[model samples]
Target: MKVGLYFGTFNPVHIGHIIIANHLAENSELDQIWMVLTPHNPLKKKAGLLEDYHRLHMVHLATEKFEKIQASDIEFKLPQPNYTINTLVHLEEKFPKHEFSLIMGEDNLKGFHKWKNYEAILAHYHLYVYPRISESTIPEQFKDHPHIHKIEAPVIELSSTFIRNNIKEGKNIEPMLPEKVWEYIDHNLFYRK
Candidate 1:
């Protein structure tokens, strides 16, 4: 089956993440979406990240109800400084039976050229991009990249960083996340030190 690899940190999966995955699964040709949780991104600071297992568990809890969506901890075992190209290459080798593609947001559109082995990725994989409200100023150079297609899924501006900060401050989080997601966060005391 053709699948979309929806890779992210998913430090604590929220309603927005689930909603987008469901939208793609329902509307797109993808059979399912695997939420590949990255343990560490080479380009970003690792200070605020929850443990890999915990993050995976959060994704597990958040996506429990969706048959077409799954949480993956594959990156936890892969070599560090995780890059998408390497992961895709590895998965293709391991699961030749399942064809895989990419799912991402528009914020990542401009930066795609800078990733390691970007050319190979563009040539090999089909990228399914959702419109991200935060990145309104994409450079003109990124306008016509090959293999990139914009999806019409409804967008949400909510972010995990904002949710994490709200939790740190002891603020109400129910409004920002789904009821089940809130329960999972509260049950695990995630982001509450």
Candidate 2:
């Protein structure tokens, strides 16, 4: 199977994430899109981040109905301070028959060169980038790279932080989240700090 790994902390999975993942799954040649839930991202601060399982459960809630998209807890089993390179290598070994690609936003592309063994990643796997509202330009070297495919997906500006903040302030973020996810958060009182 051709799978695109869409990695995220997914503190609280929302509609924007679902929209982008679904867009790639339906519009691109990818057979499946795995929403890999990361336990901890090296570049991000830990504050306000939900526990791994809570985040994973929300992802499951958000993607349960989508046949082409599924939630993965693959990173949770790996070592902490996870890096994309390590995860990619592990996935390749675990699923030799499957071709794995990356699903990322245009904003991430600007810092792609700084990732661990980024050159190796480019050499081994194709990157499918969706549009994002960002001011940074993609590096010159990656502009026309064969391994990088810029998908003309919709630009979703919504974010988990925005949803969390609104919920904390007693605002209705129901429309910003998937129905099941919204219910899960409402029941558990998540992100209402």
TM-score of each: 0.91, 0.96
- lDDT of the candidates, in the order given: 0.84, 0.91
Question: Which candidate number would show the highest lDDT if scored against the true structure?
Answer: 2
Give the residue spans of candidate 2 off by over 4 A: 41-45
* TM-score of candidate 2 against the unseen true structure: 0.96
lDDT by residue (102-176, candidate 1, tens digit) is 999988877777999987887888889998977455557656766677789988888899899989999997877
What clash pairs does model 1 have? none
List, residue by residue over 81-177, the lDDT tens digit for candidate 2. 7789999999999999999999999889988889999999999999999888979899999999999999998788899999999999999989999
Query: Residue 5 in model 1: shift from native, Å?
Result: 0.9
Model 2 residue pairs with clashes: none
Residues forming the 10-long window of minimal summed lDDT in candidate 1: 135-144
Output the TM-score of candidate 1: 0.91
